[model samples]
Target chain A: MNMEVAHTREEDKDLLKVAGEIDAYTAPELREALVPLTEKEGNLVVVDLENVDYIDSTGLGIFIGALKSAHNYNGDLKIIGLNERVHRLFSITGLDEVIDIGEEREEAK
Target chain B: MGDAYLRLQEQYRKILNQYLENKNEQGLYHAQQFSKKVLENQISPEEVVSLHLSTLEESFPDIPKGAQDSFEFLLEVMIGYGLAYQEHQSLKDRQRELESEIDVAANMQQTFLPSGIPEPEDLDVGVLSVPASKMSGDYYHFVHDENDCLGVAIADIIGKGVPAALCMSMIKYAMDSLPEQRLQPADLLANLNRVVEQNVASNMFITMMYGSYDVRAHTFQYAGAGHEPGFYYSAEADEFEELSAKGIVLGIKRHAEFREYQRVVAPGDFIVLLSDGVTECRTEQGFIEREEITRLIRNHMHLSAQEMVNHVFHELEKLQGFQLRDDFTLMILRREV
Candidate 1:
């Protein structure tokens, strides 16, 4: 299915909530939205993939690219609300070790 | 009047013959030089059409009254053809430039592959790699260290062509610069991840399986960074087990960690590693089952390691109608009793 991305600003952090599949075709949209945010200095970019049903290698690549962009600007990028399958995918690829993954906001507090 | 018509027809035929016969650059140069003179003389398109139409009128005084409109329509068509020809020529030139660029990128990508597979004592190794296009996103390297350990790594970039080739090159140099981390699979991948995250573009990442097999210890230690899971075949028990590990792909995070998995190689046991091109092989009915690959490996287990790899490749290629849609890389390591 096509992906839907919603952007919102909470205090100093930028949140991008992504829904639907993030594959070769739809990942570009997410990249376009997140890359600029990552480039901003000291910006905290959190991508919510809670509703994202599937993510392929291409999608993973986009996230990596955004992460690098954030790091370059001394900013930070985090991912939150991954489903079991998506979490397994992140773990399998060992991305769980690198990216900041947060629990649901309420659970964390 | 008839004489005048015949002479005009003769002149037109002569010009056409001249162009067709002298199709070389010299002929074209002369034509271009003549056209420059014509332009200097200020010959308008309407005047040119009128000049031909006047000849037709002179040749046949009794010509149909509607012929002027026909000639004007013909002039418009000719103008359209000229514009189309110019467009086509520019497109051909652009295509040539693109072809040469792809050729250069393909050559550079070739250097990233292992020059030769190292033959470690007590182990047989085989490798088959092919790219679906001019540039491949797949990469494999074998590093044999002084400690009787062989490091095997297979990686696939997310995209293809020059970008992917560049990523593979970065991975190669990164691995080379980290000589101390080669023995430990998890450490090697973690280090490689940092290199990739720091260097590669945000839109690119690599999935890789890195392993080191110590011949004296008979142990294979491995780690995966979102790479395809390989299979371990036990000839003694006649079972195929997967070499699965947890990790995210490289370049995704600065501090990505990969867990290392280890297996003690028993005699008659073989490890098979492959890119997604193998497991994602498409058939008329869609992707073939991963079990089919395991079955192919089991069927060829009796042969030498190289032959076994070849057999599976041959069968898979046949299934794909000899046309692969992605980069394919398969490597096999076997312990001979």
Candidate 2:
């Protein structure tokens, strides 16, 4: 399914909300919308993947790349509001160890 | 007829007329050029054959009625065959491209055989890896160092192709770089995890089990990174216990910690390690359970290590009606006094 990646400024943090399947086809769109925010000066990026049903490695790669970019710029990036499925992806791939993924899921089911 | 078809037909007619009139190499060259244009323009071969029949018939007006009818029938048949043949050729080209991608993966993949694996006098080893398709996502490598240590690692990339092969290479090189230090499984796994997270392009994650059998100590120290649990068979107790070391799959994080598990191998005891394919073997009935796999191993306990592996593989292959849904890999490290 096609995914929607929306951006909003939450005071000091840049919130990127994504919904639908983030696969190889749609990952570029997410990267396009997400990478710029990470590169901004002192940008605190927070990605909300609560509504995202499936995310392939490419989509996760975009997150890693953005995190590196944020770190290089002396900024920080974190993920929040992940559903159970998305959370498991992070846990299994061990992204949870590096990325600051929050436990407060905005949506369940 | 549409303008495009008319233009193509006229072009085809001109080329054919020139070829018929001269009947020389120059004419044949024009024919070849016309054929290329037809394909480029997405023209069907049937249309070309149809146009050829109509154009040629115009020149042979006084032909016999029966021969004329036969030619008409042949054109009708060729219309279908010619179109189907063109489609088949197009599909064949696509098939070749896919096969070449698989070939690329196959060329890069390396799976150790029994002879290539290290075997200390106290340990009997058997290794078998078979890909269901032309390329296997599962890979296993061994490192035999100066300390009489047998360092073994088995990894399965979630995705296959050139990317999976590259991931395997990264894992292999990381493992190869160890052994010299006789590092613990946890440390080795952590180092490998870093290599995957940093170097891998984030296209795949790998589940791996890394371990070393110390010949002098008679101890097997191992760690896992979200891989299938290995089984330890106690010759004295005649019982099977699962290896408990656990961690996440590699490539998602820059750092991962794997807890190491240690077990002492005594005479006649064996350690069985396998990829998911062996445990998840599906038949018409459905996926066989982990217990079933353990039972298979128990039944073949009397056989030599390599023979046991071969028998189990054949049994699972037969159960699945000689078709494997996934790559199958199984290794046995049996201790013989």
Candidate 3:
């Protein structure tokens, strides 16, 4: 299934919301979304993954890329609202420690 | 003598079975000759077994299918053993190559993709690409200057698999060396077409759309090289505008001129660039109407550039049930002006 990307603006921050399967085939959308975040003069960019049903290693790599890009600019790239499956993947891969993954979007802020 | 012949026939069958099972063709041949002699009452089963065992060191030859080894063993076991034989050697050779060919083709297709999108400002460009097979002709990349102006291109070589993939690589490297010529989209296409016509095979051609986004001006100047007409959705009109150029596909004619199409994408306006893969996307009902694609943009025309592109991909997947016969590439440029 093709993944869908949606976002909501809250307090001048772009809360990018993502849903659907993110395999090597569909992961480019995530990368495309994150690349523009760097151009915006925002202090924080929060990615919400609550409805993301599936994610592969390639998808995790995309998150790693966003984290690195955000770090380079001294801005913060944080993840919030991980579903159970995505949370399991992060914990198993130890990405939870490497990234700012939170239980909820509000918690991330 | 007749009884002896019956016993010899049984012994030969056993030897052939062993040779076929164990994949021993030379042994099977030896056993066949010995069985013939036994039927003529010139040798006994014991003599046949002894002859094979003694000569096996020198008699065995290469077994192609491992089918004859058991027949050889059965020949020996019946004289008290047997021998074997193999089938078509060419089939095994082809089977071995099929696996490696797939790997090579996948690597070749991956060569066309950019390792990373170049960093640029003013243009929120996102490329979504998916190859329909192990190898495809779809190619996309972003080139950025120190000034943050980015040149983005998406093209499809007119074929599938290895040959198409090879042509794409050639175009990529040629584009890399033509930075001085990339100032205008038409000049870029002209140079690219000249190079491709000379380098690629006569049967191959490329359909490409190239855009150079002026970050400072918030304008995108692009040229279509016989590719699909891209859509420019004006937030002011709430309708999709066609930005098609009259030009032949690359490699079609040596001096076919390409024309540049320019549009000012204001804040909240979007320019959607795509390969024919999107228009040709077949649904259960039929091929999706170009109008429907534009309507989709109008519906989500308010989202970020990336989000709108992603939603279009999602909608196409839903319409076609996620099966794409051709390469699907889409780039959505939203002006953050």
True-contact fraction per candidate equals 0.86, 0.14, 0.00
Q: Where is model 1 more than 4 Å wrong at Cα?
A: A1-26, A33-55, A64-88, A96-109, B1-66, B77-81, B180-182, B321-323
Docking verdict class for candidate 3:
incorrect
Error of 3 at A4 (Å): 42
Best by lDDT: 1
Which ranking of candidates, highest TM-score first? 1, 2, 3
Residues B118-194 of candidate 3: C-alpha lDDT, one tens digit per residue: 44555566668877776777888787776656788888776556666787889889888886634688888898999
With a 3 Å backbone cut-off (N, CA, C), the pairs that clash in candidate 1 are A65-B202, A92-B247, A93-B226, A93-B247, A93-B248, A94-B247, A94-B248, A95-B248
lDDT of 2 by residue, A1-109 (tens): 5999888898788888899988657888998898888788888999988788666545766777787788878888899888766776677555676689987686555
Task: Kindly list the per-residue Cα lDDT of model 2 for residues B170-241, writing each as its tens digit.
Answer: 776676675567788888889888888887664457888888998788899999887777789999999999
Candidate 3: tens digits of C-alpha lDDT, residues A1-109: 6899997778867789888877667877888987578456445788888777667545766776676567667777788888766775565434565578986434444
C-alpha root-mean-square deviation, candidate 1 = 8.4
lDDT pick, better of 1 and 2? 1
Error of 3 at B148 (Å): 3.0
Model 1 CA lDDT for position B139: 94
Q: Write the per-residue lDDT of candidate 1 for residues A1-109, one digit (tens) a residue.
A: 5999999999989999999989777888988998999988989999998788678777887887787789889999999988866776677666666688776432322
User: Sort by DockQ, best first: what order?
Assistant: 1, 2, 3
TM-score per model for chain B alone? 0.81, 0.75, 0.70
lDDT of each: 0.82, 0.79, 0.71
| Off by more than 4 A, model 3 | A1-109, B1-96
